[model samples]
Target: MKKITVLAGDGIGPEIMASAIAVLQATASNYEQNFQFNNQLFGGAGIEASGRALPEATLQACYDADAILLGAIGGAIGSPWEKAKQTPEQGLLALRKALNLFANIRPICVPDALLPLSPVKEAIVKGTDFIVVRELTSGIYFGEPRQLQETKAYDTCRYTETEIARIAHKAFQLAQTRRKKVTSVDKANVLATSKLWRKVVTDVAKDYPDCTLEHQLVDSCAMRIVQQPTDFDVIVTENLFGDILSDEASVLPGTLGVLPSASHSENGVSLYEPIHGSAPDIAGKNCANPASMILSAALMLRQSFQEEKMAQSIEDAVFAVMNEGVVTPDLGGNAKTDEFTAAVIKKMQS
Candidate 1:
């Protein structure tokens, strides 16, 4: 049996998580896959209950689980939760570090049916599908010597050859499965870290002869993402660049509410979460979209459980619902969170 730790964090987290869990149950039952989901407190909920953002029990639970499925965390602005000594985001970062999750995979694909909903012209967003393989748990986000001083504040962006190679292999391997193209995004034009990144990735690319590798400066890459998103197959970059670019790429799907992310370590429990944060404004309203979270569960199935058939079932069910114009308020539909989830579950059952 697969032990999956479920963290229904805060705000619309619980509502969306409830929908995703229902879908998981349906999928598990249909496939006869043994799954034991253990719900736990995290983020603001953990803080409220146990006086810590990531309680010790929650950490231990995650350590023992085969994989983790997380709803969004972090409270809204002006709330006491945001002003706490240890923020919800700290908890999330801690969890990532604890698990040693190094590769963050975020896939962005815009279906033709949702073209009208996209801000970009229909032609531009048409056939746009790509994955960003970001080197998580490293780079400036975790670099040392970070300090705020009287005259200036500074952060370090560091990467060793090993860090660059492992993620490069992941990007190249993923590219071989896709369009056989990998675009390594770096600020090599300006940063020492980027130079090492470019060199290391180039060396790694030699191993995969079938895959083509190209390097792009982060600025042009950001522009090209909006200008020609379809041109990219897989983008591998450092933590800071990936974080920004992935958020930029989220717009291509017509809504941030539909983007899912997966972070995996070489040896440890992996994490699945939506790129979107807790929508405190819409908490308990039953109007938040659950697609991202549901898709996140599908990612867990594919990456952690290696249950491809069940994962595809979930994906196809979600696609069928979206194509039929059944979605939550965020998707320009009036269907509530549970209503939209039920529609997906019905498709899965059918």
Candidate 2:
């Protein structure tokens, strides 16, 4: 049995996590694959329960688990960081560091079913499939000597060669599997960190001769994401740029509710979560989209347990259900979270 730690964070987190769990259970039953899911407190829920976001017990559970599936965390954007105590996003960042999850893989694919919903023209957004490989544990997010002064506050953005190399290698290897194109996005023309990023990524590309390597400044890359999205296959960049660019790329699908991400480490334990955050406004409303969380579970099965058939079946079931006009509020459908999840499960069982 695979031990999957479930962190159903704050807001709509619990509801969507329930959907992912139900779907996983259904998939396991159909495939005869045993899965043991252990629900644990994290994010704002953890702070409320134990005065700490990444509670010790929860962290321990994650370390011992085969994999982790996380629902959304934090409040409606800026609200979580307003308080003096640790924010949910901070806890999440800490979790990434503790696990040494250096590579965050976000796949942005505007499938044919989601074409009508996309803001971009169908001729441009159609068949737009790409992956953003982000350096998760370092860069400005973890940089030292940061201070919030009364007049001038600043955060450091630093990286070592080793840090840059591993993520670069990850992107190139992943590109080899996809379209053999790795586009390293950075502000190389100005920033010192980005210059090093471009140089190191270019160096790493030499190791993967089969994979074609190209460089694009982060600004132009962001513009192209909305203009010529299909031109990119694998976008590799530092934590900050990757964070921004991936969110920008998410717009192609018309909503963040359909995107799933995986943060992988050298060790076996990895994390799967939706690209969207906790919609505090919609918490307990049963209106949140559960497809992202369910797809994150699919990513967990495939990447962690090597259960490709089971994973693809779950993903196919979701797409099939969505194509049948079953979607949540964010997708312009009226189905509640549970109802939508049940529809997907029913499709899987059939």
Candidate 3:
């Protein structure tokens, strides 16, 4: 039996996660796979229950489980926790650190059905499928020597050779399994940290002779992403760059509501989340899109449990549903959250 931790966070989290759990349960039964789920609290909900965003019990649950499926986190509703107190976001960072989940993967693809919805031309957006491999644990996000000077604010942008090498290794390995091409994004023209990033990634490329590697200044890469998104196979970059780029790349699919993310550690602990945030404005409305959450569950199956076929099944079902024009309002469809989710689950079971 595979044990998984379920953290249904604030806002529309619980509602969407309920649908995912139903699908997972149905899939497990249909496929004859034994699966166990443990519910735990994290984020603002955790803060209310335990006075901490990431309670010891939740961390322990994550450590004990094979993988984690998180809905969304954070909301101004009924929470006095300040950002400086290591709020909901910190819980995510701490969990990533605790699990050594150094690699963050966000795959952005233009589903054919949604091509008309994309801001870019139909021809340019038709077949764009690429993955962004973001180094989660290091880079400027966790860089030391950061402090506020009396007159100026300062934060370091540091990357050790080892840090770059590890994430580079993962990117290369992924490239081998993917399109055999890797684009290392950095600002080598300006920042010293990016200089190191370019240098280390270049050196690491030598080991993957089967993979083709290129370096792009972060600025140019951003432009090319919109202009020629299909040209990219896999993009690897630092935390801050990835955070920005991933959000930008999400538009290729025509709906941020359909994107999913996975954070994986070396020891097999993984966290799956939708690329979209908690849309408090639409909370409890039964109209928020659930595709991203469902896709995140697919990622959990693939990365954490090593159930590739099951993961693919879920993904294939999603594509089938979308192709049939059954999607949520955000994708220009009339289906409610439950209706859309039910369509995906029906396709999964069939």
Candidates in order, TM-scores: namely 0.96, 0.97, 0.95
lDDT score, candidate 1: 0.90
- Greater TM-score among 1 and 2 belongs to 2
Which portions of model 1 show Cα errors greater than 4 Å?
149-152
**Quick one: ranking by TM-score, best first?**
2, 1, 3
lDDT of each: 0.90, 0.90, 0.86
The TM-score obtained by model 3 is 0.95
Model 3 bad stretches (over 4 Å): 76-79, 148-152
Candidate 2 positional error at 38, Å:
1.1
Write down the worst ten-residue block by lDDT for model 1. Answer: 78-87
Ranking by lDDT: 1, 2, 3
Q: For candidate 2, write residues 1-350 as lDDT tens digits.
A: 88999999988889999999998887787778998889999998888887778899999999999999999788775664437276788889989999999999999999888998888899999989999999999999999999998999999999999999999999988998989999999998999999898889888889999989999999988999999999999999999998888888888998888999999998759999998889888898999998889999999989998999999999898888889999887878898999999999999988
- Determine the backbone clash count of candidate 1: 0
Tens-digit lDDT track of model 1 for 1-350: 89999999998899989989999988787788888999999999988887778988999999999989999898888878876666798888888988898999999989776787788888899999999998988899889989989999999888999999999999998998889999999999899999999999999999999999999999999999999999999999999899899989888877878889999998889999988899988898999999999999999999998899999999888888888998777778898988999999999998
> Where's the lowest-lDDT run of ten residues in candidate 3?
76-85
Give the C-alpha miss distance for residue 124 in model 1, angstroms.
1.3
